[model samples]
Target chain A: MSPADPIQVHLVRECAQRTKYVIDLPEPLSLQAYQELADNLPGILSSVFLPSGDVLLQIKLLEKEGSITGSTNSATLHVLLTKEGHGRLLEHILQELRNQ
Target chain B: MIDIREKVQFVPHLDCGSLILGGEPHVIHCHYYNHFLQTSIEDADGIYPAEQVLVGTAQEIGHSQFRKLFQEKGIQDERERKSFVEVVYSLLGMGKVSLENVSAEGGEISTPYEHYAYTYAATFPPRPKGKRGVAYFSQGYLAGAIEAICDLPLGSMGSRQTACLTQGDPAVSWEFFRLREPLPLQPSVGEGRYQTASLPQPPHTRVPFQAIRDAVLGLPLGPDPETGLIEAFDVVLTRLPGNYYALISERHFQHMLSAIGPDVIPLVLDMLVESGHVCAFNTLGGIMCSAEWDAVVRPYLDNPADWLYGIVALMPALGWGIVEPLTYPSSHSWTVSLHNWYETTAIAALPNGHTLTYSPFAEGIMNGILALVYQAGIAEKRLTFDGELYGSLFRTGRTYQSTFHQSRLQGAPTDVVEGHVAR
Candidate 1:
């Protein structure tokens, strides 16, 4: 959690089923950590950096639905956030984005 | 504020599974059923003078309901009557309205939040031109309320949805005027034919049906004070009169069969069933994914297939009637029987309903439960509810299918639907 990294979480919507977080990456991922991130706390609904550099990394957390999620790419890694504890982190991230 | 949610008490006939609201037989239904049934009704627009049946049916029911409420509650003042109608409209999750400008002479009112206009708009892509809009339910209800308030007869007032949110309009607006000639209409067949039996307790499942049912019943799914829309389960919802859905659906199906000929039958039936599919994905999926489900029902889940049992066990609370699981051989397959089901029971009671081979709506619901629960692994948090995911699960190769072994609407003892992965 370095201030130098400055990850941007654009939008955060809490819906009936899941929490949707839209973020813009300041820098691309290593592509090596795809499997590791896919195996954790929040499910990656759609994490695409695309052949073009456009990014849409929507991460969702459904409690008790278990922790395995996300899709991999030969291209640059799409998202690099492990937002396990959904409540305050989401609110804090949104507040940070607002402050920015 | 009228606060009709407080004024109109819901007396639940727990035995028969009937919910009586404002002296009308009301049942809680999600947007999926509402939009689909409306599509089926509006499908017969060309040949049948469908407006009479579509809007008129709502008018008849609204007229009856408002009249009863007026007499029972002794609602005499015109201003109060107007407030009561608008409040009840929002209370049912149909969205808000402004009745200040409406009167016996022609007048117009508008809303940015009519449920039919908003949800129905989302169901389809915005047209480049000519969106007739989908707020007829609210349209006719308001029209009928106007009639009752003005002390006019049932068919004395006429209304039109001049512009709606579905049409890409900023607000949904309707114009009401005294009809030059009152349309011929019939009063609603109140609380149509109902039969009941004690719910079955199969020895195989551990999900507590009663507690979940009670929990759902207790949720105060009322409208927001500002917006006046019931937003829950990730979708706009309504506690509608079930008979209105039944009559409109049956009339459309019968008319399509007779006037349009046998060629349209398959398409019509498919659309009817697809409505149920929509319900399962949105309504049922929303329920399964919600925090309330986590607190109330999710802990009871042992096997993935138990999700199916947990869902059906409490559907009677929605007043759709009792659902009993006959067997759950595997996650890929199962069989469940519906007894005294709402759609079938209503159709069996209505005169024109004899022609339906199966309950199109219910069968679609069966298909969705399998497509979602077992195939899509909804319980495992894999469900994303996007178009691509929906296609892969419901339309692509090796999709789940449902077969009706018995149909109670056709006089069988009980309606049985068996689901499994397609061969």
Candidate 2:
């Protein structure tokens, strides 16, 4: 809930090994946090730094909607686009934010 | 403690080639189609009264449907009726809701599983305002169900989604209350005027319509016992009311034509039709490449072009209508006719039958069927579907197109959709 608290991630829809997920940031992701996620993304995921200061992700990771909640109203970044892996990519997103 | 799922039945009107549930036709469509069509209507928010059109259509259909269901079952108890509404809502894979304290006067109800909100949030990634309470369909649907349960006159009740789980809330919630002034609603034409003739059986086609239809219907297309969501054919499925789709699309077309003028015709028509393309590309393509297709319908695909026959045969089972191929197997340069197709039927049922031309949904499907059967490489199971795939296949490259020779709503013998070769 705090600005420095770790983000919450939830799975949305997964089909044909492709997925969609949300990583709730109570506060908007700092540029550094976005950068850290991009840098730390699994090799399967190729990240493109968007001009709008958001990251657009393509599922190089090949993978997965569930009841999604806990995203804040600040802004929805193309942040940590997790759609191709199991829950690990989402866990990676949350853990990396915690490390940050 | 009756088993709820077992209670719901999709009776086959094989002669008409339709599935009737709770006295209304139902069709199986995926999230892509639902999301696309819903957003298309939502996109015209300011241009027209989009919310009114969307919510009102749902409320109207839901009211008509529940009223019949309650009578058929003789469900007299208020609590039993409420429980019945919730069960059917989930049974159809719309999403599960807690109608725990919901009633006719007004009430607040929430669920993590409402279809529209959850799917919308999943489809579009995080946005600044956070998309909340997008369950407009549920808003109107539950409202109508309550009114029927209470035996209230149509439009006596109204509902609004207050919070959406997709919006970061723990659940999607709605506030239902008596409308200060009841809406003058159009009674839902439960089943439209459909021409009944023997289904077209082209002599050369190897796939027999009756055989495939019976097999496809036998497949378990029901919702998960727990989540009440159907994840089949590689897409989340919903047994959506046939009238809900008919009312929204036809109403939107009418609104655009009247308010925006004829100059907007080409643009609006193209956009509306694209939802069908999205359905065929994703839903149809997904089915062709699915294991279920291999098990049930695949054996009938005796020839390369028979894929078209095999797929169309399953249309009725999905409650779309009786799809008869006027032209034989080859994908391109063929014509398909629809009898009692939900879109046209729903529209004709409208008082003073509206003139919306050929159904955009059918046109898109006609074009998409060809593309999926031939272009997407589904025969080889080499489909690589994504957001980009639609563009590459439909918007660009050598793309297919459909020309509507006749429209059922326009007093044609039947709805005819002809597919032309790629441009």
Candidate 3:
């Protein structure tokens, strides 16, 4: 996938009343792969926020036969915060992903 | 095959909240620890003098983690942000725990096995979404779950000298109220009767006294002081079962009075004996007026304005019962009745003063009493002077029986003293 291309990503709330942030991957992603990435997402994202503002991002990965693979990965970014004070939280995620 | 791995349901109600520690999401289980945290942390500093240090430490840690998580996650997206925060809020529903300053770091901290413990049985808020749903979690949720569980830290140390070590933060209020000291002895007078030293009357104080007096006149006085006498107000503050702190009104004193019958008196006692405070007072006898002591303790005990827990054992009788598996249960050592009985009974008049009697119903009351007292002295290895005196006085044959009593066996009495008649 080219970085310039518009990656298809949807920011959806599974429950109207709940505040959980869910990003649907176009292809299947295995439970373990999703969890491993999700577990580190907070810390990685916390470390990557830019001085300018909040980080906006998401990743798409393949889930084949209910198993996750890095090659199947895709990405999206969201400006979750306006001020850099807390905005880097999202940036940290992108930075960690880039580092990986 | 029943696939347990499938995405079942995420019940928002089941979520207690989450604690973000080190950027890790720690999910709080509502059923497990929500109410516990609410009571622990609602306070500004999470300070409490409970025998449980874990609870205090957990509260402080949880609070800090919570504040940080929110500060870091300034969720701007309306939909996604709500979901994230709802999870956080549910986790906060878990109880709080904190600790006193490290008491000699690196040393082993005490646990429940070695100290007094307390817990609030609370009711929780229902699921925010529709009622029907189960909570599902992936391994990613474990870190948060563990963080939440870590909130209630258990400590075994109790500050009392007889206790091994103080376990909990001593600042938190407890359901049990103690008097400052033991009842001061009224000066002894001629004859067996107590001189009943006159107490200083309530001064012609202004304001509050007038308010109380006016309130009293509005109500009908009962037959006797014991019945109608509104001695003093006992204020009880307790964290209720429904995740709230309830302040019992003054009217609730009637319920307390009924629970711990009128026989219990508020005598002038030492602060340690009275133990009205949550912490243990030093055991020392200090001269103070009895009425003054009673007045000091009356407000906390008598006023219903005090906070009371829904599950608190207010009455001594309600406190009695062998909690199952008696060994590890918290109620095992609950001596409410025994303590109350000891307080009401005069130790000096008993066959063995100071030495507590374990058995009450013996066939030969006197013989059993003497034998038990005698045995106690020998067991303590104090059979020299006072011990010897007790042994001799309580021996089977040496005890004096009143003439014309049931079996006043006299003359060449082969055996059978009053204490050993049935034994």
Candidate 4:
């Protein structure tokens, strides 16, 4: 894919009870790229990769009861990504985005 | 009189608690008689008996060693012998010693001892604080060394540490007096034998003040492994009084934190945060604050972003290990993880075992700095620990999370704060 081309990975909820998210990739990733992405992701967000080769991105999102109520609370985003999905994310950030 | 500038060679080796110096191995250790007496001695009356026995025994041992070393050198001249004794004292890391007046006939010497080791060691205990010139082991060592060199009879001399650094004196001064009668011994308790306990050792490596200062000064001002901004903080911390940076040994730092206790940690944090505010205002003032935010901290000011990068860059200056950032399921709030934190490590190093204590002072300091830089009030702060790494976060604030939370509530406002925008 080109640097300007958008590579969007779909976020799939892993479990209904938890805030876990998993991103499935269209292609399998090389071991080298997966490792590189794993090493570098800490610079962006606090995350860990599961033994199943899925990356978990943890984020805190602000949640409000309703649009009209306006009272807000905090929530965590447990995002998981497949090896290929992580590789694409890293490529888009480190390579393509930097070129722009 | 021997010249004061003569250099002496010393070989040192650490053997258990003692720091043995010189070729023949003259052993010297910073003994904690006070700690032993306080913890082990049962009755108030038993204290003096225990102290006398312990000090006398140590003195006798020191005297024999000094006699052996002196005789081996075969220095007949009195002044030369005294000078040699001074060198030995200095070589043992016992601080500098200079004799002022020596009276051979009177059997006394007036000397000034600067940076005596015992005085430095005494400052660690939070209670039963030290009095001026109460370094028993040091006083005993000095007397023994003098008596050995002078060839005086055993127990013929008594020395008093007149001035002490613990009492804010620049140096400890000693006045040695000739004793007409033999030393008096008090009755001993528990089968006429005294038991001594050792002081707790520091967990982290103790770097000399000069070494730390030099290392900090030698750091490159340009972008290096860590950011120069953090290096600047290192310089400031090193320059604080009483070797504040080096004095903060891992064990001692932990002791101080545990002493504060968990219930008091939040209050201490709040106080530190307030202090940070006052300090920030005094140093940077209100005007230059915006210009001082580094690249790492600038971007996070507007959006709800992870602050791990900034914390990681700043950890070394704070004397911490690599921090792992952790996130909770509820609230997009993130907390920095403290791995092998000074307190945690120190508590683990305790010999008698220790109860778990948590202090959010580190988190408070970070939050305070962030609040000051972003020019925002802290809204919600929470601290948690999971056996290891202590995790903490500020959920609501105008700076990182607060600004992001506010924007999210107001339909994702595009405009950033004026301070962050200026950057």
lDDT of 3 by residue, B248-352 (tens): 111111232344454421211111111211110000000000111111212333222111110011111111110011011111111111111111122222222
Across B284-360, the per-residue lDDT of candidate 1 in tens digits comes to: 87677654454456667887777887788668777777787888637667888887677677667664345776787
**What's the best-to-worst order under lDDT?**
2, 1, 4, 3
- Per-prediction RMSD in angstroms? 10.4, 12.6, 31.6, 23.0
lDDT per residue (tens digit) for residues B1-423 in model 4: 445324333221211111122222221111121222222221222223434533453355456556766666667777777777666555444445555465533333333343222333333432233543445555666666666767876666676656655555555566777778846421111001111122112112221222222222223222111111111111111111101111122223234355555664444334433332333322222111211122113223332232223323333322332233333211223344343333233333334443323322333333434443333321122111111111122323323221121111122211111112111
Model 2: residue B367 alpha-carbon error in angstroms: 0.5
lDDT string, candidate 2, B221-319, tens digits? 777656676766557789988889888887888888888789988887888679889999878876775544554565556666788888888888888
Give the Å error, residue B95, model 2. Answer: 1.1
- Candidate 2 TM-score over all chains jointly: 0.80
TM-score of chain A of 4: 0.30
DockQ of 4: 0.01
**Model 3: docking quality category:** incorrect
DockQ values of all predictions: 0.04, 0.03, 0.01, 0.01
Candidate 4 segments whose C-alpha is farther than 4 A from its true place: A1-100, B1-46, B105-132, B168-170, B184-423
Give me the TM-scores for chain A across all models, comma-separated.
0.36, 0.49, 0.29, 0.30
Winning candidate number (TM-score)? 2
Candidate 4, which CAPRI tier? incorrect
Off by over 4 Å in 3: A1-28, A35-84, A94-100, B1-240, B243-423
Give the CAPRI class of candidate 2: incorrect
Model 4 lDDT tens row, A1-100:
4544343322221111111122223333333444344344422223333222333232222121000000001111113232333444434433522332
DockQ of 3: 0.01
